[model samples]
Target: MDDDHDDFVGCDTWDEMTAWLGESLPDIPAGVTIDFGPKDLHIGDEPLDDEFDDTDPIEALCAQIVVLKHGRYLVRRSHVVMEATNYLDHDASSATPNLWFDDDPTGDCTAGSIYVDDAGLAAEICVTWLRAESGLPDPTEFGFDISEATHLPGLPGTDAGWSLDDFLRRLGH
Candidate 1:
């Protein structure tokens, strides 16, 4: 709802992107596991064998966010654990990424779009997340639909949601 987020689009570094996400989406809660793989020079991801490029400033980043109407793995009443990921072709290219969100940790991105800027992509992802948390569907105003995808086949995160550890261990970390 805040068009003021345009300034963040110019950010091209991991620190800057994370800082912007933190400040803008403060209500997203605290203590969620994060793979600062892109923030580093590619040391952490090699262990997990995750697919990402190290040539750019930020190749990949994911957040295990909380969702509504479903429970995480091994929990009946817990909120569903979902992940939002931003992947780029490479760092420093300024290519608009199509951020993905899904119910399962290893699930393919169920929702997203092709934006002209980075900050805008982040902003739209936040908006979609907030909307879904409130029981709303993906914002079609941005030009895409999560409902278009078939249900993902995968396991859940913890009651706390997907952890970087789960993703790692699954990848032979």
Candidate 2:
């Protein structure tokens, strides 16, 4: 197993984040759908009607996660989807939908949110969340045993095993 901490962290802008995702994730297929709500804000599905009107911040954030995960990607891609919504009026945030790979308790993964005013802050928040949710030895630690998680097969950019198509397909049309 590679102990390299080569995992990219800390992005200063949405563009940078996207670029990072592109590099990190394997190639997405043509039929695959990435539903980012709105023309300019193409990250997730349609925003909730009362998202802006809602007083609570967490509620709005949760709503956005639903829309963002609509997009699909390969498992080995390691790509995460992010969206910008008017719900919080913040610069940016992130959300994950599926948390676990299998029935194994140790295989648990999380689909949550990280809100911040800037990319730098957002990256920090993501690291913190990863540390807290995974219960790893350290927050900075990467590459843990994901044997419980389903194995992803295939090459980058192609619709191979565990591709975005596979993920969305599992969700059902």
lDDT string, candidate 2, 1-173, tens digits: 11221122453344443444344223332222222211222222245444544242221111111111223321211112222212221111243323323231211112433222232333333344444444545322232111112223674443245454333332231
Which pairs clash (backbone N, Cα, C closer than 3 Å) in model 1?
56-91, 57-91
Candidate 1 has an lDDT of: 0.28
Q: RMSD for all candidates, in order, please.
A: 19.5, 17.6
Off by over 4 Å in 1: 1-106, 113-116, 136-173
lDDT of 1 by residue, 1-173 (tens): 11211122334443444344444322221222222111222232344356545442332322222211111101001122223333221122342224322343434332322322333344444443434444423222221101111122695532434433333333232
For candidate 1, the 10 contiguous residues with the lowest summed lDDT are: 69-78
Clashing pairs in 2: 27-157, 36-42, 36-43, 36-44, 37-44, 73-164, 74-164, 96-111, 99-109
Among these predictions, the greatest TM-score belongs to 1
- Give per-model TM-scores: 0.22, 0.22
lDDT of each: 0.28, 0.28
